[model samples]
Target: MGRIPCCEKDNVKRGQWTPEEDNKLSSYIAQHGTRNWRLIPKHAGLQRCGKSCRLRWTNYLRPDLKHGQFSDSEEHTIVKLHSVVGNRWSLIAAQLPGRTDNDVKNHWNTKLKKKLSGMGIDPVTHKPFSHLMAEIATTLAPPQVAHLAEAALGCFKDEMLHLLTKKRVNFQFQQSNVAPVNTTHDEKDDTVEIIKLNLSRAIQEPDMLPSSKPWDFTGATSANFAGACNAFPGSITGFQYGPSSFGNEGAKSPWSQSMCTGSTCTAGEQQGRLQEKLEDENGGESEGGKEIRNGSSIFNTDCVLWDLPSDDLMNPIV
Candidate 1:
């Protein structure tokens, strides 16, 4: 008996596969199951190698693939998750169920990765600040708000401490606004506006919003937060600073979009020069409000959001 190679050259061919071959290979596996790829073609009457058969089965023929263009939120989640996990398409896919590793890998290479790179975001950092901000806004609730409020207060204290040291040096020579600096102990009335502004900026920033809301400390309020801000040398008046003081409303400022843009927002209006394009398409319709609201509606709650298992599993629908 003459010996032929494991993949008999006479019967087996390599390179591009045809639809008939595809159907035969698919049908054979669908019936008998795929225990051995090398032997599959021999029985299935395919002229392709086992390797080719496997590749076609896993990449294209598999039934589980959820094919289509990725939605905006999926893009956002992918970008944000990618920031933390760089290049791990399998891991990233696990977090986005019904999405295959190959699909995500292709999407990242073809679309999202470039978009993120163009945005000047370090794709390696995996920290999609814009998406991160949206997540914070959508995830945070009243209880979470208190935690963030405290974080802001904490940041305020740190700034005040730094400012005090600077103030002593910078203002020692200049005797302006230094006349008997109201050395009183009234906590509420004797507060300084600068501290309030600094605190608000630190706390309200969308990225920081997550850490601000300490989930463990749920019932924490502004009054209980006095000790938290005690480290702040200057007194704090009221929470006078809101979103408006930041000039965020309707403003195309980067800070406005990065932090102020709500969770449920859409894409078409990301400001910058891109705003003109979006505006033109919408006939000058504002992309800021309705789009964002739509995104928010997609993930109504963290319960639903977190409940979604990552799409990284090999369990394709097929």
Candidate 2:
């Protein structure tokens, strides 16, 4: 069904509330107070619908409404609020006294947008153009395996560009004490050289990539690798992201999730035995374990973590 209109009567007045009309609406509300907006028009004797009357009061005729230019502090508040809430105008307006959502929306459309753009920031994303593009590139980059024999690597385009650009920017800084670039050298050629140099280096020395995360892979992980407790490889236990993602917390032993326990068995047999063991240990809550019967999580969780170096590494190209 179509949405019901707030008002349907043709005789109801529309647009341009005159002083007498405003006076009548205000006087009635002052005495009885705003409760049911639908009944306000009838009680107040106004020629407008309840919805129109509500807007007329809240957006314009509110007693506490503040007029005049938005102060610098207020403008900063709007920008900060906007960065967090996006386009929730009513929320932004509530933070500043005497401002309506309409007022805040108009000011942002007319003024704040231009101001942010002039400062080289994206008014929507609130990031510098270079940084935004780098993030976009990374998310969009297709997963590529470095080699069938290597552990798969997850790449960030942001890191690659950051490394490339940092070299160009710091070449002549005072702290660096490096000699200035010869004016005759083309900047374009230098950038191309850096890209080519690092593109190959990324494959061989992925750890050198800034902010690299170890467990990120390029494609859909095989079902064999998928944990019963969690789909992500970061948590072999399958309960959470795990104690430490980087392995910097020191390695835990017998880490591979292989079900084989010295007694030789088929892969299928091993899996069945593992699942039965887990169900018995966890009292039948394996997929997101309930109780760790053996005083360790996740082992009440059975999963597979492949032994490495047979992993391929990949980073974004763009």
Candidate 3:
């Protein structure tokens, strides 16, 4: 068996359609509706193929066709419909009056696809590109494990901050004694020594006591604390605070440790450990004593304590 040709290539005119051909196609379609596209060209006196005649009439010469630029509403409709139907140009064109399937397909390929891609949306899937990438990443790796690890880190940070704030540990301070100027007059001179103390301490709690709830860093907006959470670690049994060095008084704070029972520990346990550590470390030191607990006994003289405001500590600086 032999295949039949759609049209005779030798006799059919190709390339751009002439004005006469356009007029023929328009007039024939106007007089008689397009029932059979294979017979349209022959009946309309067009030397082009039936397919060519149908395309010319539907895309260009149709009286109901929208000739000018597509309106914003029309463009939006095309995008929405394309998202739902996905490359079914004929179905999309049916909804858009006067728009041919060929025109819609061309617009989608040339402009709409690029626009959607620029907006971080996948034109084919109609989903956010970032979301798609996240799904792919999760599929490749175990997201649960990653989440658990991040939660553990966040819990550790929150625990540390809670302990530091609850204990009311006296931070290290620099003391300077300035002597008053001497007077050479006949009258007696009373000289007073001024002591300057630069103290650093974390913001105190509302009632000057630790809160029952754990300090939450999850609400923080800063990049440093973006993924921080209040989730307690299941593996950690307890926390121990030990003296890193010896004090000049020879009387040092006792080692304090708080044990976590079962799977988790509360913020109170952390605070208890901190309180015990601070008491043992600075219990013997007097108010005017030269030594202070700087969270650790290391560098007894030059320890520096960094203080954070209450609001700033809770909600980190972005």
**C-alpha root-mean-square deviation, each candidate:** 18.9, 19.5, 31.6
Residues 58-110, candidate 1, lDDT per residue (tens digit)? 77787766677775556655654454345666655655556766888899887
Per TM-score, what order, best first? Answer: 2, 3, 1
> Best by lDDT, which number?
2
Model 3 residue runs over 4 Å out of place are 1-6, 142-318
Q: Which ranges of candidate 2 are over 4 A from the true structure?
A: 1-8, 139-318
The local lDDT score (0 to 100) that residue 296 gets in candidate 2 is: 40
lDDT of 1: 0.45
Candidate 3 lowest-lDDT run of ten:
192-201
lDDT by residue for model 2 (85-199), tens: 5677876675566788899999999887755443324567653322333333343333332231122111222332332244332222222222343323364344333323333
Candidate 3 residue lDDT tens string, 141-164: 454534533443343333333322
Worst lDDT 10-window in candidate 2 = 308-317
Please state the error at residue 173 of candidate 3 in Å: 41
lDDT at residue 173 of model 3 (Cα atoms): 14
RMSD of candidate 1 to true structure, Å: 18.9
Candidate 1 ranges beyond 4 A from true positions: 1-11, 127-318
Q: Estimate the TM-score of every prediction.
A: 0.39, 0.44, 0.43
Candidates' C-alpha lDDT: 0.45, 0.46, 0.42
Q: In terms of TM-score, which candidate is stronger, 1 or 2?
A: 2
